[model samples]
Target chain A: MSDSCCDGNARKAQAGDCCAPDGNVMLLSCSGGSNVGQLANQACVELTQEGFGKIFCLAGIGGKLSGFVRSAKDVPRMVVLDGCEVGCAKAIFKEAGTLLRGYVVLTDLGISKNKDFARKREDIDQVKAAAKQASQAQV
Target chain B: MQIKILGPGCPKCHKTEEVVREAVAEAGVQAEVTKVTNTMEIAAAGVFGTPAVIIDGDVKVVGKVPSKEQVKSWLGK
Candidate 1:
């Protein structure tokens, strides 16, 4: 039902076929329905522009398609960005059978989740900075 | 060039990566493909959905994994 051209084709690809990488951080972020979700989305854009990591999709893993999931699982590491404490992003990774090298929750950084909220740059920075530190620490 | 397979390792992530390589190979471009597999790292990269795509640090697709042709276009093929 989506407008994008690849919607149907993406679903058709197998789950286990991994697309080889030339050694860069291919990333997946959970744009949840919360403020942190929005923050995550924005941060991904910044990171992508900054050459920090490459963005990948998350729904495909949940869909259980063969190619995307398989290629993703074959990666050296997969990062999960969970907003608040729900761990929704992590849940997707778990279902895909991929080992997560790092995991982050916005609430852990003191960001309150509220229905009527406006995402702030500072809040996104806090998460982004924290995630960067965590990634460096993991390495 | 930087190759990105955006997803948190879902089926889409795997597909994205596969398509990325195919696109890169088909285009004959040398680039680095990164798998952002860390929750904290992913958050640092800034994503709210399970599957997303960023090319060379630029968020290209947010929610869904596009097809090989779409990916090719994202890669500027």
Candidate 2:
């Protein structure tokens, strides 16, 4: 009997050992009006699909929604991906009085911010890697 | 002093309440300790975390259970 919950899944059976979705990890990304922002958003979407974590509504926290704020605060693990140094996502957590953990800034990954809406695949991959690294470090 | 433990009745929240009560007794402080399990009340207090400890309306801890010593310090012991 495998002790890991993910081991029971056929997907994990094919893919080998992997982490199961515990529903404790939350992902928040900045969907700002910029390429970097979109990169962050795109990375979060992909990561969620891969079961890295579930993408949460940053706007809810920003709007001071009670349920969203409570969920964000109570989650055992959180990944915050910001498109740039502008730190809109980070600022939201700060303003909401919630502890910001596992933060990653796309600009810090050497991906320069631009007005281009067409996000590059390489940049998206880089952001995803950074986001994964940030989340793993917290774990 | 008013002390409130805010959580949605998780095990950690229960542990927090126990730690707080013990802290109050050991600190010998004249305080009223209350457990707040209501989600709206927890959020309305401007706290987003569970197992939160509020002392006299000021949020002291959130999201994690605190040790007895930590609770005692918050009680000014």
Candidate 3:
């Protein structure tokens, strides 16, 4: 149960209702050691703030926590964002034996991977769009 | 042979159990069928999807309710 008033029942509840976290979609980001990774993390943060979905911990799943792994498996919809083709996020899910759904690779979105910590707003927006699109297509 | 249905007791999970039982009876296979409703157990079994069917330690289906015919085929009917 959420404390927010918007429960998808009110006519005022728009698509990106920020009243509460959307349980329907879960966001997982790589947050690795790269600019693209930072972008992925930033995009997820912004999306969660915008109520697109609730950001979940990939580390918990990577650590093989029973509760975290179970939650990841049980979530109705999930968006996984990876910084690069190395697919750190995807590997974590695979190692946990969890099914991957609504996956997006930042590099695949025409964003180049680099050591630069400074991420561009345009790249972040692109990642966010790609994440939303992937989630919609999958669930 | 051992058969396990993994889920959190959702409607689909129950439906899967019913179909699996029907297939077992129709196929006349000497298999023990059980439901695993524990989330931890399901994860330990390496199944991330609900309404999953595991036969003889092999995962046969995941995330969807399979038909009776599909279960029978797994039972070699």
Ranking by lDDT: 3, 2, 1
Clashes of each: 69, 0, 0
- Highest TM-score: which candidate? 2
Worst lDDT 10-window in candidate 2 chain B: B42-51
Model 1 DockQ vs. reference: 0.04
Better of 1 and 3 by lDDT: 3
- What order do candidates take by TM-score, descending? 2, 3, 1
State the C-alpha lDDT per candidate.
0.62, 0.76, 0.77
True contacts kept of each: 0.01, 0.05, 0.00
Candidate 3 is scored at a TM of 0.59
lDDT of 3 by residue, A1-139 (tens): 1212222233323333322223447788999999999899999899888888767789888988654676677667889999999999999999999999999999988898889788898989989999989998965
Cα RMSD for candidates in order: 14.6, 8.0, 7.8
Clashing pairs in 3: none
Residue A133 displacement (Å), model 3? 1.4
Off by over 4 Å in 2: A1-23, A26-31, A41-78, A86-101, A108-112, A116-126, B44-49
Q: Model 3 - which docking category?
A: incorrect
User: In candidate 2, what are the lDDT values of residues A1-139, reduced to their tens digit?
Assistant: 1222222344543452222223446788998999989989999888878877778789988987655776677667888988889899999999999999999988899999999888899988988888878878876
Looking at candidate 1 chain A, the ten consecutive residues that score lowest on lDDT are: A1-10
